[model samples]
Target: MSHVSRSAAVPPDDLSGPLTLDDLENRADKAYARHMETYTAVTVLHRVHMDHAVWNDTASDTLGLAREMVTAYRDVTRKEWYEAYIAWATAAGFEIPADMVNDGTDIPTGAADDPPDHPVY
Candidate 1:
């Protein structure tokens, strides 16, 4: 596999404006999209590094972390990342209730082309 550096793909830390965790959370889809792009690049880089045995022939956390992150990326790729977030959060002991997010809103059947937006992403 070919590898590419992330310098060109990632936005500059100071690009457009100052960065904040909240800002990132607010742009979840955009952030996830960029993350997946850069992650693909970095994974290629790591595979190359492993091919060259740059890590001293010892297994490291990088591979596991990459797998976990990819799982997370797939979870967030859903149209309702925020809904999943709320569910996960509640299961994790947060106080968010489903009604607070879903609000009994009706979605037309067979509306795959227009999935409802996740309110809490």
Candidate 2:
């Protein structure tokens, strides 16, 4: 199992205190960056699992399950990231821009392309 430590990615201390528009904007940027970083990492890991499964017959089930988990986690992370941004914006008394919100209705759920017979490991 691979672990990614995020202990150093702590939020800025100014969030608990008086915040200017600039502070709010900076927070939003950091949140977005973190979300993107997670998304990219998950995507890479999922691809790795899928590729390994395709090439190695013995570990297909395990890798498939791992890929499925990564997919689900990616979806949840995407949703939670958006929610966190909205919460931060609300706390900062800033209006959430319409483009920033993705309710996931229009996005692919990542499971649609999975093979039907692969059992979870």
Candidate 3:
């Protein structure tokens, strides 16, 4: 909700030194927050703007393209946020495990607490 960037949180000004676990956690938290904001905004646009555009039948091609782009953006946002969350959790604990599906990949939904295959809509 505050100022967040698309990149990691600001690190120590001296780059010569290695970052501490706390530092890494902070960075990951910022990354997660940044992506979370983006994902939330994209979802709102899809639900409100795209939904309206479709119902009105306004520029079907354009709306379809916009929907495609937003979906891609949402997917990326979800991934990045989850990665950051994992990193932060790992830093806080010893090792934070990912939620894996039977396919050997992540649950493809959200952070550790998300239900498997939760619908984005």
Cα lDDT tens digits, model 2, 20-75, are 44554565677556545544555665566656534556566666676677567656
The better candidate by lDDT, 1 or 2, is 2
Ranking of all predicted structures according to TM-score, beginning with the best and ending with the worst: 3, 2, 1
Ten contiguous residues with the weakest lDDT in model 3: 110-119
lDDT of 3 at 33: 70
Q: What is the C-alpha lDDT profile of model 1 across 1-121, one tens digit per residue?
A: 1132222232224467643333433455554355445445445545655576455424456655665666465444533444434433433345654444554553112233223222122
- Relative to the true structure, candidate 2 reaches a TM of 0.44
In model 3, which regions exceed 4 Å deviation?
1-17, 43-58, 94-104, 107-121
Name the regions of candidate 1 deviating beyond 4 angstroms. 1-32, 35-42, 45-49, 54-59, 79-121
Candidate 1, which ten residues in sequence have the lowest lDDT sum? Answer: 1-10
Candidate 2: worst-modelled 10 consecutive residues by lDDT: 1-10
Which one wins by TM-score: 1 or 3? Answer: 3
Off by over 4 Å in 2: 1-34, 46-54, 101-121
Full-model lDDT for every candidate? 0.44, 0.53, 0.53
TM-score of each: 0.26, 0.44, 0.50
